[model samples]
Target: MRITNRMLSNNAIRNINRNLENMARAQEQMSSGKRVNRPSDDPIVVARILAFKTSIAANDQYQKNMEDAKGWVDASESALGMATSTLQRARELAVYGANGTMPKESMQALGKEVDQLIDEMKQIANTSYGGRYLFGGSRTTEAPFVDNTGNDKNVKPVIYNGNEANLEWEIAPQVKITVNENGQQIFVDAIDTNTGNKIGIFDLLKKLSNALNSGDYSGVEDTLSQFDQAIDHILDIRASLGAMSNRLEMSLSRLGDTQISLTQTMSKLEDVDLAKATIEYKNYENVYLASLATSAKALQPSLIDYLS
Candidate 1:
């Protein structure tokens, strides 16, 4: 079959169009720095890239949660430390108040000091972080320990309003950790392991205050062992908080490692090789230019030549 000038021109134009499209794709990849701009570029690779991006984003949020939990743990630890020291000071006062030779005025003065310590301990129990109580469990917005002692030994006293519940943070895929200690656990319900007595440090303080005021030497002396027991309980809780903090640090490290690995995988899936893309674009551009020149010369010999 004889080839017509129309047919030859149409074929060359079609080849040039395809070459132009290829060059455009290469240029886009070079400028955008992505191998796949649209889904049609390579559907499978695009899908995988999207998945990688989503995983990376979720991992980032988990990392944020880890940071938040760390702050909570630090705040709780500081508060517990303060409470422990306050108890120690009260113990020293108790030792003095327990002496039979102490004058009534001296006992009253110590009683006043113990009362002040009760207020201080209440403040510690109500420690807040980011406007939320650190020891209130889920009732973070409310004060856990309310001081209603009101100088009335016969009536109302300090009370813990919060329940014993754990507030947890999700630090990993399925792993969760406690970030706050409830008031009941730390201040109210601490038990004496040696005697099975459920006397808390706050209750011990109230009893000691009354004993000092009345010059009840026996009652005051009886408090030293209980105070020591309460101190030990606080130490135990503080140790647990420290252990959780260390675990959270490990989770943060693991998250960082996972994020790095995911980032590299995403780059492999979507990031363009500039050197390779630029070379390909030049190759397609040259082919398109050559096709244009060839088509111009081939179509120039028109049907009019045969007629002539």
Candidate 2:
């Protein structure tokens, strides 16, 4: 078929448009600093970048959870430490009150201090973090222990109002950890093997108080072993919390490593090298200019151009 002037001009225009499109794409890549601006740029690479981004987001959430759990663990450890100190002080007073030669007035004074320690211990049991009770298990919104010993020191004054449920936090995919201790286990229901009696920390304190106020030397002396046991129990709780804190730190480290790897991989798939992109854009621009020059020269002059 014979080629007409109109067909030659159309062909020249089409070639120039293709060259201009390539230059625009290179310029966009340079400006955005990304190789895969759209899926059409490289569909497989774009899909891989998306998957990496999703994994990074999940790791971010896991890190946040570990941070929150760490706070709870630290708070619990501090409160339990305070409780152990309070118990030690109370035990020292018990040793003093156990003296048979001490007068009833001195015994009463020591009993008053023990009573104060009871109040302090109760406060420790009701410790809170971020306005939530740390020892209350799943019942974090309420106080775990209530005082009922008002006028009668002989009565068991502390009652546990919290449940035995464990509060769990997810620090990784399908990995959950208990973040709270049951108030009932820590504060109440401690069994005394010798007497087959359920003597908790508060029960021991109330008995010691009554013994001191009435100058019962034997009762005061009996509490020494129980006090030692209670102190050991608090230490056990603190040890458990410490172990959890260490595990959370390890989990956070793993998440940080995973995030760094994902970010590097995503950069390889999605980010553009500035130097390479600039060179590519310059090459495309030169080709576009050359195409325009060639098209201008090859297209035959029309009747309209002659008239002008």
Candidate 3:
């Protein structure tokens, strides 16, 4: 092999550039605090990091869904609880109105109070959370119960405007749960077997109020059993809401655990050790300097250099 100054200088330059590239990589790792700055750095690790990040993002979405479901269930439970209390009050009023000896004026006053309670029950049935009705099934924007009775006594006092569709939320991968109860089911399905008419809580309240105002003691007495049935229905719905809330809480806990694990795994794959990166950079810099020094001594000076 013909050894020459040109060859020696070229080799030295190439070695120096390689060392500079190594040092630059180490410096980048230190500055960015990441081992894989680009895909070329470590393709396998980069792929793994991307997969983990996608999983983490999905977990976050599931957690959010569970939170939304929890809010809906909580609001529904609170509303149902209020409904039960309101029904109990109506039942007490019915008991009082059933006494035939009560004066007509006293019965009419009690009927007025019962009417007010009916309005309160409507409010409870149309309860909302975050501007969406909780008991309206999938029809969340509209009130579930409305006062349709005006001068026409033939029509039912309360009309249900919601549907029977169940609203579901995905709290985990491939796992969905119902978060809403059908308002129609809860408020409009109870039938008065005696009269062969649907006498759900609202209608039951209406009949009781009409009986008291008209001094019909028998009609008021008839409502006591219906009120009991309505209260029981509301309690059953509330129990289901409680179960849904528990499931949502469990889903949230699982999502939190999965998120932590994904983050740790991602950190292991991509995060750089600052101390190790710094040491590697220093080593590369020292080797580059040493190579430069040796090249200066070994490569003979050109004649043009001396003339200059």
Candidate 4:
């Protein structure tokens, strides 16, 4: 076979360029600690990495929703607890005021305390967290209960201005959580079976105050049964809050497990195996060095050695 200098030089240049390209690719992989920097590196691996990244991002969002749901539930539970305590205290005062043996002065003094408790309960019902009403159901941006006349003295005369909508948060596929409680249902619209009228806790407190101020012990006795109803109302609200707290805790646990699984799957898809990557990188380095040495030798003139 006849070989020309033009052919030899062209082949040498081609081989050197190929070897340098491979060396550059290996160096990039090593420096970035990634086997696939671009889709052209490995189309199949790039696709898998993209899918894993998407899943990771979705899982992150779900986790954030879970955290927000937990916070809202926690704040609601605390407010409900305070409201429950206020109801219990009001019930005690109602019982004390119902006693005919108690003097009018004492009954009037108890009315003052009951009125104070009414104000306290209103405060709890209007509790806000992060500039959002905790007990306002879906109306997080607005106050749940506002005084009818918008005055401090009439604060006990609160109205349910918020709607009975449930704030929903998605924790996973097909899994959602109600992150709010309706104050109207919890505090207002409580039915008194004896009168067939909806008598709320605030109304009962107001009646008690009126009865004590009039020195009507019998009227206080008649409203005593309503106090029991109010107690039951508080219990029911607390139970509902407890159930929601439990659901939130369960969702948090499941979300954590899902996040862990997603992390593992993402790692498997995109993370580099250091031991295998190091071995492959070393092999590519050796090949690149060998190619460089061979090209040098091939390009050198050796007429004396060839003749000998």
Candidate 5:
């Protein structure tokens, strides 16, 4: 079949347009450094990128939760340490007060110091971080311990108003971690197994203070025993807080690894191979230039060249 001049010109124009379009697309890919600029470029790859983005966002939130948990754990550990020291001081005073040879004035002086320690303990119990109580459990907005009356009868008197609720945060899908501990259970004494009566650190301190003021050396021995038990209770809570800190650190490390892996996967799915893309872009550019040159030659008119 013989081809007409108009048909030849039309075919040449079509070829030039197709080559130019390819060159433009290649340039765009190279400039953006992405394999797929739009979903239409590769629907499957686009979907995968979307999923990776979601995973990254979720991981970021988990990391933030881990940070907040770490802060809370640190605060708890510090407060517990202070309480332990205060209890040890109180124990020493109790032992001194137990001696009958000590004068009444000396015992009163010791009582004053005990009163100071009690104040310090109350301060620790009411410790707050970022305007929220560290030992308040779920009642973070309010003080954990409140002194209803200011009298000496209520001097060491403080009530644990916090609940037993454990504050929790979700670190990942189906994974939750307790970020806050219940102050009532940890700082207060366990309910007596025999009598079912509740006792706490404050209750023991109150008894000790009363015994010292009344010059009752007989009750001093039992009060010292209770003080020892309170120390042990606080130590156990500190151990638990330390364990929680360790867990959060491990979780943070794992999350860092996960984020690294996700970033690599996202790069593989979306990032352009610079070396290969450069070569492809060059090839497209050559084709575009050749098509333009050919079209220019086809559009030119020469009678001698046509005859030849």
Candidate 6:
């Protein structure tokens, strides 16, 4: 309790420095608009902030995956639709050619048109999206269907070069969607149970083309049932793909909502209340100025100051 000018002045300087430190913190909050500028500022809140950020990062990746899945599904649906349309044209040609009034030359012309339709179907089976084949299964880099028949043959054979493996994407935690279907699933799986043969677009087109050229009018009519089956198959698969698109759209909406919620939580945890910080800064500044004033009066011209 030995009150001396030196002791009083030292204590006042220390108090001023402490007050300045508090004011600096307030100023920093105002400038940065963050309450927890450093981890030491609020350890618990900082920990929560980090966790929220981590969740947001993971969700963002899923969001991107959902987008990619949507793209794949849309491409597949479009390609399947085209394939169905080609099959329809082939069916109409068969019906027209089946008319007995059609002569040999007419049948041959119909056969030529059927050939073009088969080629179109081949192109569809080997369709690519974003540099990858939509129906190539997991072997997206390679064309799934190939023309295997020799040039001498009037009717060509098509070969499947892809597997039945499905391509998938993870749109959420533990949630996956098949983004692609193998060529076999779309074009080679529709078997005609009566004849124990696949009625898929490729096989049926070849048979129909052969029948038209050979002047087999009944044969043309026979392929109609098979064509209907193939179209039905494509429609069923396309419906499934459309459902996937809707699901992906829902996932995107949920991701948008979740991102917004996470961002709001993070803001609450880390952002400074500007009004509160401003008030605190002003109060600390006043206290520091008052301390300086008191210190000046107490230390001014004390006789002990000159002696020391």
RMSD of each: 2.4, 1.9, 2.0, 3.5, 3.1, 2.0
In model 5, what are the clashing residue pairs, if there are any? Answer: none
Q: Count the backbone clashes (under 3 Å) in each candidate.
A: 0, 0, 0, 0, 0, 0
Tens digits of per-residue lDDT for model 6 on 1-308? 78987798899899989988998999999999999999999899999999999999999999999898899899889989998899899989988988988998999999999989988999988989889988878898999998876673344468788999978788778988778878887887864659575545777888998999999999888888888888888999999999989988988998999999999999999899999999999999999899889888877886665794
lDDT by residue for model 1 (1-308), tens: 99977788789989989999999999999999999999999999999999999898888989999899999998999999999999999999889998999999999999999999988998999999889899888998899888665666333367888888889888777878878888887887875635675766778888888899999999898889888888889998899889988989998998899999999988988999999998999999999899888888877865687894
Model 6 scores what on Cα lDDT? 0.87
lDDT digits (tens) for residues 110-195 of candidate 5 = 88888788789889988887788987888999988887475644534877888888888887888998877677886665323236
TM-score of each model, paired residue for residue: 0.92, 0.94, 0.93, 0.89, 0.90, 0.93
TM-score of 5: 0.90
Worst 10 residues of 5 by lDDT: 186-195
Model 3 vs. true fold: TM: 0.93
Which has the better lDDT: candidate 4, or candidate 5?
A: 5
lDDT (CA) per prediction = 0.87, 0.89, 0.87, 0.78, 0.84, 0.87
- Candidate 2: which pairs clash? none
Arranged by TM-score with the best first, the candidates are 2, 3, 6, 1, 5, 4
Residue pairs with colliding backbones in model 1 are none
Off by over 4 Å in 5: 150-156, 190-196, 302-308
Q: Between prediction 4 and prediction 6, which has the larger lDDT?
A: 6
Task: Give me the displacement of residue 151 in model 5, in angstroms.
Answer: 8.5
What is residue 182's positional error in candidate 5, in angstroms? Answer: 1.7
Give the C-alpha miss distance for residue 1 in model 1, angstroms: 3.2
